[model samples]
Structure formats: C-alpha cells, structure tokens
Target: MKTSTVLIVILALAVVALVARLFFFSKSTSSAASAVMENLMTRTSIRAYQDRPVEDEKVEQLLRAAMAAPTAGNRQPWKFVVIKDKQTLKAISGHFNTMKMAEHAPLAIVVCGDMDNTYPADGRDYWVEDTSAATENLLLAAHALGLGAVWCGIYPMQERVAYLKDLLGLPENIVPLNVVPVGYPAENPKPKDKWKPANIHYEKWNGGDSAVR
Candidate 1:
C-alpha cells in the first residue's frame, strides 16, 4: 500500500477510536447522572418501619454519610446521639405527637448542632444550616442502604427542645435539631409530585418556560 493511503487509513481509524471513546463515555456519564436523579426522586419519608434492628456496620455507614455533609467554614458543628434502647425510643415517640413511628423503629439518631463553637452565643451560629445538611445526608444514605427513616423535627419547638436536652443530657451549648427514626421498611410510600413550573424562573422572572407544568 502507498504511504499516503496508509496514513489516511490510520487517521480514519484514529478518528473512529476517538469518537467511539467519547460516545461510550458520554453514555456512561448519562447513565450515572440518571441513577442519581432517580435515587433522589424515589427516596421517600418512611414512617412505618419494621422491628428489625440495623446492623452496626450499616449504622456506621449512615453516620459516615452524615458527617460527609458540607458545612460553613468546615465547622461541621454537629453531634449525633444514637438511640437503640426501647424506653428512650418510646419516650421520643410519646413526646412528639406526630412521631409515633419512633416507638417500634429499631434505631433513632438525634442530630444536634453545637452552639458553643460560635461567638456571642446568640448570633447566627450557622449551626442550624450545618446540622441540617448533615441530617439530609443521613436520610439519603439510609434510603440508599435499604433502610427506612423519618425526620421528626425537634428544634424551634421550645418545649420539645428542653425535653430532648434533659432526656439526652445535652449541655447548654448543644441543640437537638431532629429525631430520625430508622429501621427496615414496613411500608413503601410514593414520592410527592413536587415539580412546580410556576415557582421556577430563569435569569429573569419572565424567562421561565411557559410550557412546563
């Protein structure tokens, strides 16, 4: 074969290889992105949990996921209290009118924010945001791990806050944010339709897609 023809064939083969590589990479990337979105969308608040307990390794994985959450200035002003005792779980269930699931759930995690890490003791400590992010990460991780969980709000409710603090022996500087009741799922609930086109806007208020619903 002529050198010119050989070079042309080599170039064509190289182009094909590059295009094929890009096509497969794009496909794999798209699949990964779709899996993530599906996981997020399908993850639902599970209130009915089985009596089976979560294993120690799984629990650790959940906590690890929570600690991975992003925090302001990397303060991570968070503390976690894991509850496995039946009596303590019952107390939490009884105290919160809406958190009855805590009674039978095999585990509960109290996500708290540390206030002493900040100045003034009363300013925007940013603890709330930091711990909130941690709590969300925990929930998502639980769902991914085939565990069921529910968020029971505790902070902002003065009486509930005081009760939990006293029950858990938390210091004045630590604040309980939420009680997460977790266990194997006993019931499966559908995720709510939360897409609201009217609530979304582009660069400007009028730039939203009108056809979205």
Candidate 2:
C-alpha cells in the first residue's frame, strides 16, 4: 500500500474509535444522571410503614450518607441517635401529635447538632444548617436504600426539644434537630410537583407581590 493511503486509513480508524468512546461515555453519563434525578424526584415523605424491621446494615448506610453531607468549613457538627427501642419510639409518638407515625416505625433516628463542635462566634449558628443538610441526606439515603423515613422537627420548639433531650439523655451541648422514623413503607404516595417558575428569579428579583404559600 502507498504510505499516504496507510496514513489516511490509520487516521480514519482513530477517529472511529474516538467517536465510539465518546458515544458510550455520553450514554453512561446520561443514564447515571437520570437515575439520581429519578431518586430525588420520586422521594416522598413516607408517613406510613410496614411492621417489618429495617436491617442493621441499611441503618448504617443511612447514617453514612447523612455524615457525607456538606458542612460549613467542614465543621461537620452533626450527631445522630439511632432509636430502635419500642418504648422510646412510643414515648416520642405519644408526645408529638404530628409524629404519631413514629410509634409504629421499626426504627427512629434523632439528628442533632453539637454546639460544642460548631464554628466560633457568629458562625456558631451554622451548626443548624450543617445538621439540616445531614438530615436531608439521611432522608435521601433511606429512600435509596428502599426504606421509608420522615423528618419530624424538634429544634426551636423548646417544649419538644426539652422532651427529647430529657428522653434521649442528650447533653446540654447536643441540640436535637429532628427525629426520623424509618421502616419498610406501607404507603406509596406520589411526589409533590413543587416546581414553580414564578418562584425563580434570574440574577435579580423580579419584584412581584406573591405571598409565600
């Protein structure tokens, strides 16, 4: 074969290989992205659960995910109390009206923020954001692990805070943020379509009188 013809054939083969690699890479990326989106969109607040218990392995994975959340300055000031005792679960459910579903849950996880582990001065309150991020991660992890869970708020409500602190024997430095009940789901509710284009502002607020819903 001619040297020029050989060079042309080699370049053509290289281009074909590059195109194939790009095509597969794009497809893989798209599929992975779609899966993550689907998980986020399909996750709903599961209030009802089955009598079945969540496995210990899944519980650890949930906590692992929670701790993997981003924190301010890497403070990671979150604390978790895993509750599997029936009496404690019942007591929590008995106290909070909105959290009655917790009584029947196979497990409950209390998300807390350790004030002692927070940032200094004005940034101290950043613990709330840090723990809240952890809580969201926990919820998402539960969904991904095929377990149902719900976030029952506790912080800011002094009465609830006091009750949980006393019940769980939490120290003064540890502030409870929320209690999450986890188990096999008994109800399959549709995810809410919370997207509102009017709520979005590009670069700057388009000043419009829209009351917060």
Candidate 3:
C-alpha cells in the first residue's frame, strides 16, 4: 500500500508535468538545465531515513528550488511549513497511516496553497496546480542535494487535509497539499520503468494501443 501511495503521488504530479513545462521549464541545452534534467530522471522516493538531523542551509536550498517552480500568472501562491519538532513529527506520523517515515525523518515540509492568492479561472481553482508544481520541484531538489525524501498526499483527501490543518495550526484559507519527509536515506527503492513506446503517440494520441492498460 505504501508503494502504491507513492506511485499515486507520482502519477498526480506527472499528469500536470506538461502544464509545468509549458509554464516553467524551457527547452534549453545549457549545462544547468541539463543537470536539472539528470536529477529529475534519477530521483526516487525514499521511504526510510537516518536518525541524523537535516541542516538549516539544506532546507533553505529545497525551499529555493520549490519557489523556482512556475506559477500561473506569477501568482506564486505557496506557503511552506517546516516541521522539525520530534513530538510534532511523531504526532503527524501517527495521524497519517502511510507516513511512518515522518517519525524518523529530521524534516518535513508541509506545502500549502494560499487560497487568498489564487483566482478562479474558468470556474476552477488553479492553486492545486501551482502548489503541486512547487512540490515536484522540491522533491527533485532534495534528491540532487543528496537528501532522501517522500511525497505524501494531503489535499483532496478532506480528512487528511483537515487533520494537518489543525496539527500545523494553518489558517482556514490555507490548504495543506502534502507532507515531504526529508533526511539521509536509510533505504533505497528502485525506480519504475516508465518509458513505454506503447503509450507514446506522435502528433496526436492514436486511439490504437496508446491506452495505458
């Protein structure tokens, strides 16, 4: 179930990847962008973490990477809550059944979407999209920095969302998106094989074998 949950979190981000690229990442051959791509490809969800504490400077680096994500209309509507307190982390760990790693992780960043800063577009909220993009950036940054991490979904799951809000003392207008546990890796999980020509169709999606079965 933990593995499936991780995969679900990944799929959710991947679904918005095209939109992310369209708004934030540009097609570039520069060494920096190339290095970023390398990090993206090799990053894997880390579920087990060491007992050591994560440095403050490294936390700042991850936040910087998250803020660098593209926001719709430059709204940049994201509020981050960093959790380091052992009791608080243990409380959160106990509450979220799938996030046992939080108990051992030195840091957990709760990414929230500031509804006050988001505007309704076509009668739909875009805060989720903007915040999710930021979350993906953060995960990548963690991997690049040699810190293991995991993305545990919170928003859209009303019960989990409310629980985190009360635990973290977030305002009603702020919605907790997810909990990211950060620390040195204690376990290394293998990456899934996602490159499939069966799902790829040039020009337009040919309704042939392109369906994800």
The 10-residue segment of model 3 with minimum total lDDT is: 22-31
Which residue pairs collide, candidate 3? none
Return the TM-score for each candidate structure: 0.84, 0.91, 0.80
Candidate 2 C-alpha lDDT tens digits along 1-213 = 999999999999999999999999999999999989999999989999999989999999999999999998898999999999999999999999999999999999999999988988999999999999999999998998998899899998999999999999999999999999999999999999998766765655658643444
lDDT of each: 0.89, 0.93, 0.89
TM-score of model 1 (CA atoms): 0.84
Clashes of each: 0, 0, 0
> Which scores greater on lDDT, model 1 or model 2?
2
CA shift at 196, candidate 2, in angstroms?
A: 1.4
Model 1 poorest 10 in a row by lDDT: 116-125
Clash count (model 3, backbone only)? 0
